[model samples]
Target: EAGVVQSPRYKIIEKKQPVAFWCNPISGHNTLYWYLQNLGQGPELLIRYENEEAVDDSQLPKDRFSAERLKGVDSTLKIQPAELGDSAVYLCASSLRTSVAGELFFGEGSRLTVL
Candidate 1:
């Protein structure tokens, strides 16, 4: 099976600029998630979607970040006026909702750098 796919594996921009990353989950996976990972730390959930519904997004920074999973297939995360603190890896993961262990498949991630 094809794994989760992410694009623009690297990005660099000045502070206060806008950036976006895209993701395509594996076929038939019904759950999708976007995670942020800083240096030396594990990934932290930014948002989650069960099909087209955003079941959890409390951890997302609403002021400058937004996400969407249209048609319950592809997803995109955007950050406007990004800050230096936003420099990190944006990971996209997907899984089958019926998995007993809640296994997730992750993309290689898009690394962002704010100048």
Candidate 2:
């Protein structure tokens, strides 16, 4: 089965610019997540979706960040008017279920660098 897919792999932008990243989850998976991993840190959940519903997004920065999983298959995360502090790896992961114990499969991620 195909694993999660992300594009650009890397991006460099000046502060205040808008940026977007995409993700395609594994086929047959019902749970998808967007996570942020700062250098030397573990991935922190940004948002999670069960099919088309966003089940968890408390960690997302509402003022500047947003995400969506449209049609229950693919997802996109956007950071508008980016800040230098937003530089990090945006990882996309998927699982078969929404349980906490569910194992997640991750993509290479879109690495963003804010200048």
> In model 1, which regions exceed 4 Å deviation?
98-101
TM-score of model 1 vs. true structure: 0.96
lDDT of each: 0.95, 0.95
Per-residue lDDT of 3-83 in model 1, one digit per residue for the tens?
Answer: 999999999999999999999999999999999999999999999999999999999999999999989999999999899
Over 3-92, each residue of candidate 2 has an lDDT whose tens digit, in order, gives 899987999999999999999999999999999999999999999999999988999999999998879999999999999999999999
Per-structure clash totals for the candidates: 0, 0
lDDT (Cα, 0-100) at 43 in candidate 1: 100
| Model 2 lDDT on a 0 to 1 scale | 0.95
RMSD of each: 1.2, 0.9
Q: Over 4 Å off in model 2, which ranges? A: none
Q: Tell me the deviation in Å of residue 44 in model 1.
A: 0.3
